[model samples]
Target: MIGALASQAPANAGSPAVERGQYLVNIAGCNDCHTPGYFLGKPDMTRYLGGSEVGFELPGLGVFHGPNLTPDKETGLGAWTDAQIVAALQTGKRPDGRELAPIMPWHAFAKLTRQDVDAIVAFLRSVPAVKNKVPGPFGPNETPTGFVMKVVPPAKPK
Candidate 1:
């Protein structure tokens, strides 16, 4: 199923690197969390990788939305350099010196080959920029303004 999806490249996705990246992004399930309306059974392909309207709520970490990955300067990764993107993927550290939310699986991505990582970056760079600004990385005490999928720990047996 993923293979079929990866076969259809985005309009701007050209070059070997971009294609490879698109494939990687699809197979890696980047859309599962990043694309808006995805968790709600409707993925907005028009705003692909443009960030999610829903957030994830960890017990003590508060809610975090899947941020926009498109290259829009005002609301997405446009200002981030290739190195910054790579670092965020591999190290779970944002360029602004903040650690990525725990929901982000950067540890697994850390094992990706350098070439693969570079390809992913290329693909991300080539996508059409979306102007969506996903909501917060709200603090534990703060209230989130959007829908959230909470992750609750299993209860201990008494």
Candidate 2:
């Protein structure tokens, strides 16, 4: 699967694969959490793919911000290596040695072939970075408060 995305990855410019990645990024629900303020509206197109902050005040959840997912030189994944990204999604660890908390659905994503994952990352790399400062790695699910985020229900294990 890695070959599929890499095969179509545009070298000098954004390729069709990257565009597809962007589409998947949205369809896969990456925007819901990675992009904060989704309740109000999408982030400015100028800051497409930029991360934001939203407090998770539910019982099992805690206050946290969705950090920048853009390719900005400063507050984004610009400095991260593809390996770092793949590892984070597959292993739940940040480049800084921090656990990404279970909020991010890297589990479901982890099933995707390496190539597809790369395409998503490729699309992320192509987007302009936003200067949003995400807050925390809010641990645990909030079962109390009015909010109850349904995590991916379990499927028969392979």
Candidate 3:
């Protein structure tokens, strides 16, 4: 499944960095969350990495949709510098100082080598710009705008 999806994107065949980045992104399962309709089993390849329609509902942190990773100026990461992207991935902190949602596995990503992170950013920037405005990181008390997968604590054993 991963191979098939990765193959759909146009590759920068001559750039090793882009290729490596693509490999890292595929292995990291970025599409599973960032691609629209993915959770519904019908990912939109045309808007790959554009954003998710589904949101993850943490117990107290609220709902967060996987944001668009494309370089769209208005709705994606186009405004972010390469350094900003790297920081977000490695430190889980956005340019605005907001921490990534709990569901984001940035802590695991934090261990990635600097070169690997750079490659990831390069690959993200190379993808065709997709203008998608993902919905909110709704507060715990706020109602979310789309389908959500809630994370609940396991019940105590009897």
Which numbered prediction scores highest in TM-score against the true structure? 3
User: Model 3: per-residue lDDT, tens digit, 1-158?
Assistant: 66657575545656888888888998899999999989999998888999999999999889999999999989999999999999999999999999999888999999999999999998999888899999998999999999999999999999
Ranked by lDDT from best down, the candidates are 3, 1, 2
lDDT, model 3, position 41: 92
TM-score of 1: 0.94
Cα lDDT, model 1, residue 106: 99
For every candidate structure, what is the RMSD over all alpha carbons to the true structure, in angstroms? Answer: 1.8, 8.0, 1.2
Q: What TM-score do all the candidates reach, one by one?
A: 0.94, 0.71, 0.95
Q: Give the winner by lDDT.
A: 3
Alpha-carbon local distance difference test for all models: 0.90, 0.65, 0.91
Pairs with steric clashes in candidate 2: 1-115, 2-115, 59-142, 60-141, 60-142, 60-143, 61-141, 61-142
C-alpha positional error of residue 10 in candidate 1 after TM-score superposition, expressed in Å = 3.2
Superior candidate under TM-score, 2 versus 3: 3
List the candidate 2 regions with Cα displacement exceeding 4 Å.
1-14, 41-43, 58-61, 138-158
